[model samples]
Target: MISAKFRVQLPEGIWVADTSRAFPDATFRLLSGLRIGEKAVELGEVIADDPQAIIDRPQSSIDGWELLEATDERALTKYETTDIELYEFVESSALTVEFPVVVRDGWYEFDLTGTRDDLERFGDALDEAGQPYELQSIVGTTDPESLLTDRQRELLDAALQAGYFEVPRDCTLAELAETLGVDKSTASTVLRTGEAKLVAWFLTGPKQN
Candidate 1:
């Protein structure tokens, strides 16, 4: 559920855009055929069941984070392999997306030209998994009035109504602050406090069991 902007620099004539498009399907196949944590590496359209196999022959790139392999695919592919411990971080790190970004005016701006599909899938997967984002507001057992200040609730509700969570997500903190008629820091603080309270209420002070 994390919202981020990124830019990637690819080598000339790599057709990486097409690769990314076909990737989801290929990845789907790789996952359904394997077990969790098993490594799968891609060389052109050919994906291997071995991580060491591909790491030994990484493709040349201008400057970008290669998709390599997502953990879910690895785990699904692991069903075909005997070694399972090799893919320990598959659940957390592999499934996670790291978009390369250029800092512009203190905000991360994404390059959506070539890898739009991948970014889309990344965002979708996160939403399905229920992760973090720029304007994430969790539903908690605690009543809104009991957990957050009146102003905090008001701003969050406004942000939600303003499509803050929609992709391409909108509403920068400064912009939202202007809309809410508050200083940027105050807006950020209120949102953070509200989120913290919601999380605390939802988790009920963490598990003792």
Candidate 2:
């Protein structure tokens, strides 16, 4: 995965309004020891990108900020309009906010680059809160089939042979479970988890494009 520091400068006007609508009375809050009014609030996410960026604020803080009140029209303009004084303040402003962005390394990564098969496998892993395997995690194991567990191997084998992964639809999960001599829930869990791990394995060890 590729990792880098990401810093965004938002005009106070834009920042306050976005935060206000996103949060309520408590919006635009500053750090405890910092002067509250001088600094602007920001919201961001570390997403997969050509040049990755990271968001560092805690989830609880994000939730708190989101609860603040809406921004009036005046506040919105502070960040929107280019005021010389505001610009100076922004430039000389002691405000410093920093976060890290990590981009996952994988096959031909671009915005929305993953194939259907890749997305299905990777998305499930993301849902499970699994940190991506470092880029090149599976350099030696080139075959997708080699990365899975026995059950996962069975599931994928069945899905392919029986066309479960097909668009028109193939054998149901229940059918696969019966054929594998496992309970439906057990088989489903294994298949899903295995799929996620398989995707994680596909990405090279963490390195940026």
Candidate 3:
């Protein structure tokens, strides 16, 4: 199995897109959704200074909207929408979506987990449909630690202790190499490879066996 992160451009005419674009500073998180025929019922939350703006915004695609809860900084809402292109596409594909789907700056960012073949097919479908998307990362295995070697783990731990990954790195690569008693080139290769694995692991998240 493989997990991938994708950032997709919101399709035109979708209420989520319209609202998100209208309130660029606000964050919309789709907590859950259910498709009913050509429409969909979604439960979501908005994080913004004026959470009421989302409730006040008039959108033609939204058939019904109800505010479930609200605070100064956030609001929970349930709404029915006629725009279900993305939802239908995911339903037709073999991929499984991991919510809450985040919307900000006119983009929908979400994670998908599936077999390699399923992911390839979903990518092909997106291309055929002319949907703009960015594949952020892909991890082959769910067990992140399993991807690292013993030596790599040891070096990464040492680097962490030395603050090599800090904003203003406490130690230089040469310094780390010297401490590990290895040449700079070997240390560099190991660190680079190990870092890539760690990043991929972080993106995909660890799954239970």
Tens-digit per-residue lDDT, 1-209, candidate 1: 12223322222223233333334223212111123343333221123354333333333432222343344223211212322221232233233211221221122223121123434564564465554333222222224355556876898898788777568758777888898888564566567656645554454433346
- Candidate 1 C-alpha error for residue 116, in Å: 47
Candidate 1: worst-modelled 10 consecutive residues by lDDT = 97-106
List candidate 1 segments past 4 Å from native.
Answer: 1-144, 205-209
Error of 2 at 92 (Å): 33
A best-first ranking of the candidates according to their lDDT comes to: 3, 1, 2
Residue 174 displacement (Å), model 2 = 1.1
- lDDT minimum window of 10 residues, candidate 3: 199-208
Report per-prediction Cα RMSD to one decimal: 18.7, 18.6, 13.9
TM-score of each model, paired residue for residue: 0.30, 0.30, 0.66
> What would the TM-score be for candidate 3 when compared with the true structure?
0.66
Per-residue lDDT over 1-209 for candidate 2, one digit per residue giving the tens place of the 0 to 100 score: 21112222232333323343333322232211112354433322211221111112222222223322222221110111221232233223221111111112211111111234443444454345432322322223345565555866877777688877888777888887888787564565557656654555456433446
In model 2, the Cα lDDT at residue 7 comes to 21
Q: Candidate 1 — number of clashing residue pairs? A: 14
Residue 74, candidate 3: how far off, in angstroms? 0.5
lDDT assessment of candidate 1? 0.39
Which prediction has the highest TM-score against the true structure? 3
